[model samples]
Structures are given as C-alpha cells and as structure tokens.
Target: MKNLLYLVLFLLAFSACNRKASDASYSWASDLHQRLLTDFCLTEAQVKDYIRRYLPDVTDEQMRQWEESGALECMMLDGEKRYFRNAGPNLFRIDSLCREVKLAKEGEQVSTSDRANAENLPEILAATDGRGDSCLAAPKRMRVTYTLTVDTNAVPAGEVVRCWLPYPRTDIPRQQDVKLIATSEPSYTLTSEGTTHSTLYMEKRAVSGEPTVFSETFEYTSYGEWHDIRPSDVLPYDTTTELYRRYTSERDRHIVFSPRLRQLADNLTEGEDNPYLKACRIFRWVNDHFPWASAREYSTIDNIPEYVLDNRHGDCGQVTLLFVTLCRIAGIPAHFQSGFMMQPRAWNLHDWAEVYFEGIGWVPVDQSFGLAPYAEKAGKPYFYLGGIDSWRMVVNQDYGMPLVPEKKYPRSETVDFQRGEVEWTGGNLYFTEWGYHMDIEYLNY
Candidate 1:
C-alpha cells in the first residue's frame, strides 16, 4: 500500500512535468514575442540565391556590403542566423544598385490594366474638381468571394472550427450598398454595426481527411474620393472636440511619439503652420523616404511606425502607420485605414491613412501610392495626400480593434483584418494551419 502511494505521487509529479512542458511548447508557438522571430526563416544561402535572380553577376563582397548596410535585414534566432522572409525582395527596393538592375531587367512595360488604373487617378481628381460636396465619384460595383480553409486534420475530426472573415464596413460614406449574397454556413453571426474590426462569424465541423472551409459572398459599391483644398481656406481644428482629441493623441505601441519620431516631425514641419500643409509635409517625407517592400506579419510587430523608421522601408500598412504617427505628432488628426485596393485585375491588400481636416472632415491619404508620377507631372503633386482611388473595400476603421463575439485566442492578424481569422475549440489556427483566398468580380456600375 505504501509502494502504491509512492507510485501515485510519482505519476502525479510526472504528469505535472509533462503538462508544464506542453504549455511551454505551446507558449513558444503562440506567444507574440516568440512568434515575431518565426517570419525571419530564410537562411544566408537562400537570400543570396534570391538576390542573384535580380543581379546574376552579384558577388559575395557585394552581398556582405549590403548586409552590413542593413539593406539585407537579418536576425539571430535561437542561435541560428536567419534573414527576413522579404529581405531578398526588399533588397531590390532599398539598394540603389539592386533597384537599377531590377528596373533594367523589367524595362518599361506596364500592363494595360495597370496603365488604366494609373490614368484613372487624374480622371478621378479632374471629375471631383470644384465639387467640394461631391467627394465621392466613379463608383464601381464589386462582388467578392472570400474563403478561408483550414488544413485537413488541423483540428480533431468532428470538432467545430470557428472562423471570422472580413466583411466590409457599411458605416463609411464611400462604401455603400453592402449586401451579403450568401455564406458557406446557413447560419452565421454578422457583428453588430460599428464593430471596429467588422467580421462575419461562421463555423464548420472538421472531417477526418477533408479541409474545413468557411466562405462568404458579398457585394458593395466603392467610390473614389478626391478633396481639393486651398491652404488658405483650411480651418483650424477644434482641439476641444472629440475627433481632434481622439485622432491626434498617441495610441499604444504603434503610434507613440518617441523622441526620435518627435525630432523627425519637428524637422519635417520646421516652418509649416497649417495642419493640412503639415500633414502634406509628413506624407511627402514618408513617401520619399520609405519605399514599399513586403512586410512581416503585423501581429508580430510591436510598434509598426518605429519598425519603419528603423528599417527605412515598409509595406503599405507599415508606411501608412509611420505617416499617421508623424501626422499625429505634428498635431494633424490622422488614423489608419486599410482593405483590398480592388483595382480590377490589380486588386490586393492595401493600407492608407485618413487625415481629419477641420473644414473638410476626414479625407483619405494614401502614402503608399504616394504622388502618382503622372499626377506630379500634371502639377497635382499631392494627389494621394487628400485624394484616393475608388477601388477600395474598407474593412477596419482602426487597427487592432476587437472582433465581434470576441476571439478566444490571439488573432492570426492582430493589427489588420483583411485576410480573415480562424480558430477552433482547441486553440487559434495560425496562418500555417489555414489559408485564405479572395476572388473579386468587378460589375458594371
């Protein structure tokens, strides 16, 4: 009996240790800090091979030089040197020589659809000219089928898999006439109106060898907006108002006005007084400084604006956050806005900013698109500053907002909601365990 008692204690202690070990393993995968390093999975050889695609004659010395200059982003993870997943492509975007070689190889061949989209910007600007109240123009009807599929055996068979897909927000003026045509599931929960990260929640039971799929078909009319403002006519913000207080104040992590950021803002707007002009200065600075590059997962990033500042290059969302942060620092009310830039055949996930002009209300600003080269040549250098193209699907009004019904686990994308998210009763399904695809059809207006 005494031996039995000892055996019971031994078993209890062993089980406890195993549980602790399992928890630690799960924490390493799910913990935000540890997950940050997961995206930096490339090796030195892989980076070199990728770079050679752009510059076949590139040498080891040149690679070393670029790495030393921080053009090739890398980190030491778990005692192994790893390069950022996008580091190779980012090299071409950041390094002058690499860019020259890349451009030379690509030449000046713009697709018909791309050229049309580019030309459409000035047309939108021209159409909206002199019509202050008619900011919305060139509306396009679109039907989108967004699908999220969990890998076979991702969850135990017969267990229910919960998924939250991004549904367009109807509160925006430009995006209107949103209609849900159908969903894969018969019954689903569409979040209450004004949920920051608007979502359509659905669930499905997993099969032993079949993937669990959640999909929705929705249609909406998106309008392009252009704000023509004369600096002299711009009015001062009512600092006492909620709009001013909320947008101008810093948000945690991403939007904080660190000393470096403050100094940079001060330098950029050294002599500028008007809020509109100040925002323009900040916008142009970010556009000029940070060229677009593929980005790591937003969830892993703690402070996006700071990351851009440190790296000197970022993707659409990254640069937008930087611009928004700078605008806030300069006392211009700015906030983050993002969704798919549904530009016909060229649609993809895109992010931009919206600045609150006291008299004009909130106008769209896309620093990623920056000043269109053609627009700049046409004397409308600030086209994207106070204007936006119509092919947009606004999903989230603000970043990092909670989803409806609330997700039980950490979000697959904690910052942005365009890709959609998934989980089960067991835990959150990371991007690896699941995949998402968006199919868009542009319908005639």
Candidate 2:
C-alpha cells in the first residue's frame, strides 16, 4: 500500500513539473500583457478631459461615437475601461474634425529652418546630377551624448546592473568618422563592427538609494544621399544572387507575408513590372493610407505591419515595416534601417527602409517623411523616395539584432534598439523602471 502511494505522488509531481515547463515557454505572453496595461493606462475620464482641451464642446455621446467608430482606441482591463496613453494627442492627428479644430486654433506653422531643410533636397539632386552611383553629399558632423538611467531600487543594492547603449556603425558610407570620446564607466566593451545592432556594453553595481546611470559621448559625420535613379536605367536583378535572395525573402515575425499582405501587395503593384516603380506604388499607397500616430510599445506587438493594416494608422517604425513587407511581397529587395533623425533642434528616434536596385545598389526611403508638401510644390514630389538628408545618426543597420555580452533576461525593447537596454541579476528593467535621454551638439557642417 505504501509503495503504491509513493508511485502516485511521484507521478503527480512529474505532471506538475511538466506543466511548469510548458508555461515557461509562454513567459513573453505574460510580460506582454503587463506592457499593454502600461501603454493603455489612461482612464476614460482622463482621455475625455484631454480631448476637451481641443474640442471644448465635446459631449459624452460624441466621445462614445468616436470610440465606436474606432477613431479613439480603448481596451478593458482589470474589469475597468482604459484608453491608449496617447489617445488624446493622437485624436487631433487622426480624426478629421479634431484635426481641423486644432489647426484652426493653432495655425499651421513650419519653422524657417525646417522650410530651408525641405528646400535643400533640390540642391542635392542638382549637385549629384551627373554623379552616377555616388549619391553621398553635404556632410554634417555632430557630437552626441546618450544616457540611460535606471531608477533607484530597480534592483537590490549591491547587485550588478548591465547596460547596452546605441553606438554608431562604422561601416556605412553615409555615416563616417566614428570616434568614441568618453564613457561614464572607465571599463566598457564596444561591440565589433559586424554586430547588426551595434552596442556599447557597461556595468555598475546598483546603489541603495541612487539611480544607476550609463552614458557615452561620440561624434560622427552624416551625409545627404540623393540617388538620381532613372526607372529605365535600373537593370533586372540577378535573382540568383545572394543579396537578391536574402532581402527579397520573407523574414520571421514582423516581415511575414500573410494572405491579406499578399493580396495587398498584388493590388498595390498591380500593373508595375519594374521593381523601382513597383516599390514606388507600394510606398505611395502606405503613405496615403496610413497616417502617422503615436504607437504603443513595440515589444507588445507580435506582427507590426498587420497591426497597421488593421488600425489604419502607425508611427514611423510601424509604417516603415508595412512599406518594407509590401515591397518584399512585390519581389523587391528591401530591408529595415533605423536610428535617430538628428535634424537640429528636433532630434528623435526614427526608422526608415532601404531598397536595392539591380545596378543602382541600395537607396534610402523614409516612408514617414514621405513626400514633403513643400517638396511636392517644388516638383520634387518623391524626394524621400530615393533621397535622404544629412541629419541622421545610423546606429542600427538592422532591427531585432542581438547585443554583445548576451543578455540573460529578455530585452525591454525586443524590436528596436535605439534606447539602451538594462538588466540586473533580478531581471530586465523596463522603460517604466528606467529612462533615456540624448543631447546633440552640432560640431560642423
């Protein structure tokens, strides 16, 4: 009887262990749920108050109507309703009525520097007019200090905290003259040039009541590139080449081609046989169809492009991915490129795409910038289609790439790597537990 009882208890224990193993595989799902809640933390009352700033006469019924029409996004959590963190500001950008009201209240104002920047594209096109395959010009040099700080008590005192901050890539043509000036820590490990997501790794022991900070100062030169691509001049891609096969092929997660994606690709590139023209059609479609809006955390999103298609809106990275996926589906070789857009006085994290033309090689395409209104008026409607400005810092040549000194815990940001990552013996420190800041100083032009 005793032997039989022991066998039964052992079997039950084995089953419990197996269940835990199965649950461990889906740990990300649990983490994602928490992230979603953080993103959608705004309460319904808070959102209403926010909208009232622009639409002073907004009524409860109207708010309901907007929510029902999907003009405003919300989710039910913890048995109570919650709205997206940016739902209020995004309302002015997304909804037609709100946009008009906001525009009326605050007239459309473009800064003088921004206007001049827009006007510079034509100059670049003219300067690089006869230079075949030599698109780089107008180099701007700048120094940048990037810092990441983990809140006090994020991890227990005396525990070691590891950090990975964005470092400029030395291999790119447009970005050059890379030099690391200094770092907060005396000892640091800078990843090799080959790392897809270039990073500078450092560590410090957490203090009892103080934030753990990591920083680096560096300088690099960025050049404006304008590819005078003539659709007729583009040669047929050597489909058998490794470059053609690799970029044109489907990637996992964000770049997958689903049934709807395939149909959308065909519809966008319906009659185009030329790869450049096909890419143009797809790019125009995404820019026209999906307007930019504030986005949720990327780590919570499983498939980015599909989310954009469903929501009818996306931020910079989201729209770029949609454009990339569509281009790949249309048999064009496209890849992801991202970093910071370092336009003076207006620097922020940004993402864009790169497409390969058979003989022309790869050219930059910023879907978010799209066709600037001024550029359109200047007869340079597709300026961003094959041109980029000098105000950029290319840190990551590709997205979702691994960091050096491999992280033991899952990254706070799994998709993008602009903001540095932090982890300790306890676990990963998410955006809520830490913060990042970047300061740019223009060295020369």
Candidate 3:
C-alpha cells in the first residue's frame, strides 16, 4: 500500500536523520501547523476537529512507532519543537496517511464551467481555401480589470507608500488598442519605455487604519495566432544586430547557460539545421522529459535551467525558463512573457516564451501547455510553436527588472512580477501582508 511505502521511507529517513518522536515535537507542531492554516480560512479548533474525523486511526502511541516519519518534520527551533509544512492536505496526514483530504467540512468538489473558446476557423479555412498563409484573428478585442490592495493598517500612518501594477504594452503586436479605465486613489504613472518591465507606478500617503488600494480597468485586443511556418520561408536574423545578440544572450540567474545546459541544448537539437525545426525539437524534448510538478519557492533555486536539467520537473515559470534558455543556446531569439492566463472559469498567474524569426517577427509559445497532446484533433501539432490562444494577459515584458521608484527593502518575490508589489517608507509589504485580484470581461465591440 502507498501508506506502507511512506511509512518505510519515513522510518529510514528518521533513523538516518536521528530524529526525536517525542510529544514536544508534535505538540508545538500542532499549534504552528494550524496557525498557518488560518490563511486558508480554517480556524485552529476547526482544523483539530477535522483531524479527529479524518484521521481517527492515528494515535500518539502508534506515531511513536515511526515517530520520525516525515508527516511533520519536527525540529528544535529556538528551544521549542516545531514542525515544517509537510506533504499533506492538513497536518494530520503525515502521521496518518490519506489519499484524499478535503479543505472544508463538506466533501463536495467546487467546480466552474469554462467559457467558450473563440476560434479562427473561418480564417484558417479561408487561408487553406485560397492557398494563403494560415491565419486567425491576430488579436481579438478584450477588456480586463487588474487590482492590487495592501492590507489596512499595514504601515504607519502618513508614510509615503509606493506600488507598481503590471500594465499591458501596446508596443507588442499581439496586443493593441490599449486604454486605461481608471486607477484607484492618488494617480499613477506608466513605467517609462526604458524600464525592462512594463508596469504602472503609483504612490499614496498611508491612511491610518485604512487599506491602500490600486486598480485599473482597461480594454485591448488579443489574438489566437497561427503562422503557417515553412522551413524555406523562415530565414535567420542577422547575428550582428543588437536585438538578435541581446535576445540570444543570457540574462540573470534563471536564464544562465552552464556546460550541462549548453550540452543538453546541443543534444536536443542534434542533426537539426532549420531554426524552426530545432525549436520544435527542443520544445518537445523539454516538455516530454520534464513533465510537471508543483515547485518550491522560485527564490530558493539558483539557476532555473540547471535545476530543471537536474530535477526533471518544474512548474510553468520554471519550465519556461528552461525552454527559453535552451532555445537561446540553440541560436534562436527567445525571451520571457508572463501575466495571467485568463481561463473562463478563473484566471491564474502564468508565464510563457516568445521567439523571433525573420519572416515572422515575434511568435508566442507556451512550453508548459506544450504541443497539444492530440494536435490532429485540432489540426495543429505545431500550434504553440508559431502562435498562442486568445486568452492571455501579457504584463511583464521581461523578468527580474528593477521597479520604478525602487523599494528600500528586499522584494518578497524577486523572480516574476505577476501580483502587484507594495512598499512604504517603513518597509516592503510581502504577499503575506497584501492581496491581489484580477477579473476579465469581453467587449462585443
């Protein structure tokens, strides 16, 4: 049984680490464990009661048998035994294993229906019908609402607070018809073109016991694009150009190229001369080999490409970095783009890559979404390679760029800027201290 397997592994780890299974470890762990769970809208008492119902089988005496089992790794922090976040839904699962753990008291699964996907079928059919380059609505019209709110009373009263919200740039071809609906409170200024990340900058005087909020409602066109890419039509960009050199070169820790990554890129594109063909090969290789897994905090990893190469798994951002780095090494002009993936049910923070070719300038590719599992079903296997679907909110043009009106304290998240950021004369407000919300509505026009 899977439970028995975890028990054995935990026993081995316990013995190797020489851990203590005393009540002191689990007791403090119980308190801090539920303390963090409150963020999920569950109270300490409710969590304890849930444990009683869900894990009636686990007992203090039995846990002592393999007390060092990894359910909750207990250690002495400041002379008190505490447990770290473990691999279970609630704190009880490590000691008492359960394949399914429900968050609320009710066992029902809450779900949402997806909005209908707008298609370019008419265009695709038109292109094939007339023998023209395959096309779709290059970009369709969309209206979006993005907001960032810092918790009330988070900073001292009257201190100058600064914040930046990701703003879509009309400069990108796939994005156009940019308009600002409104900005909350004291006015905002868009980040200058010179800044790497495209964001709206705003500041306000902290009001005593009042939440600081910033919001923008805007409309733009997003396209479901597909280029009928032909090897012969695809010409390489001149290597001498600064744009080509800049994109092909590495930037920051996430996009670095080490010997292993360089060699991996070499292997992935072996026997491939066509840039388009080479990109597809590397894209397929990374997708199939790396799979997908929940990632640890991004800040913890030193180099994303090296990490994926070594670990064989990563989330969207992590995998995108790997795919981007490998593509650049293969002599393709690949770069980063991240914002929100606006699904009908719910939008989420997401990242993807874009590469430039001669005939076609910039094309979007989502490595995590990968080649469609059954491309024939949609008549598109190289779909993501040359184009992307219509549902996307592109905010940050590049990652790891400095913020306009930089912060005095360390940024809570240093990697990608999806959720807005906040700071005051006192200090920076981490995600924990603030919250963000995004909503999108389509305009018929």
* TM-score per candidate, chains pooled: 0.91, 0.91, 0.73
Q: lDDT of candidate 2 vs native?
A: 0.86
List candidate 2 stretches off by more than 4 Å.
1-26, 111-113, 119-123
Q: Using lDDT as the measure, name the better of candidate 1 and candidate 3.
A: 1
Checking candidate 2 for backbone clashes, the offending pairs are none
- In model 1, what are the clashing residue pairs, if there are any? 224-390
Per-residue lDDT of 248-302 in model 1, one digit per residue for the tens? 8999878999999999999999998998888878877887888878888988777
- Cα lDDT over the full model 3: 0.68
| Residues 398-434 of candidate 2: C-alpha lDDT, one tens digit per residue | 7886789898778988988988899875567889999
- Residue-level error in angstroms, candidate 1, position 45: 1.3
Please give, for residues 82-201, the per-residue lDDT of candidate 3 as tens digits.
Answer: 433332242332222332443344464433212223344333433442113344463557777888888888877887778888887667666667888877854778876546677888
Go through the candidates in order and give each one's C-alpha lDDT: 0.84, 0.86, 0.68
Candidate 3: which pairs clash? 71-94, 139-222, 139-223, 140-222
Model 2: C-alpha RMSD to truth?
6.2
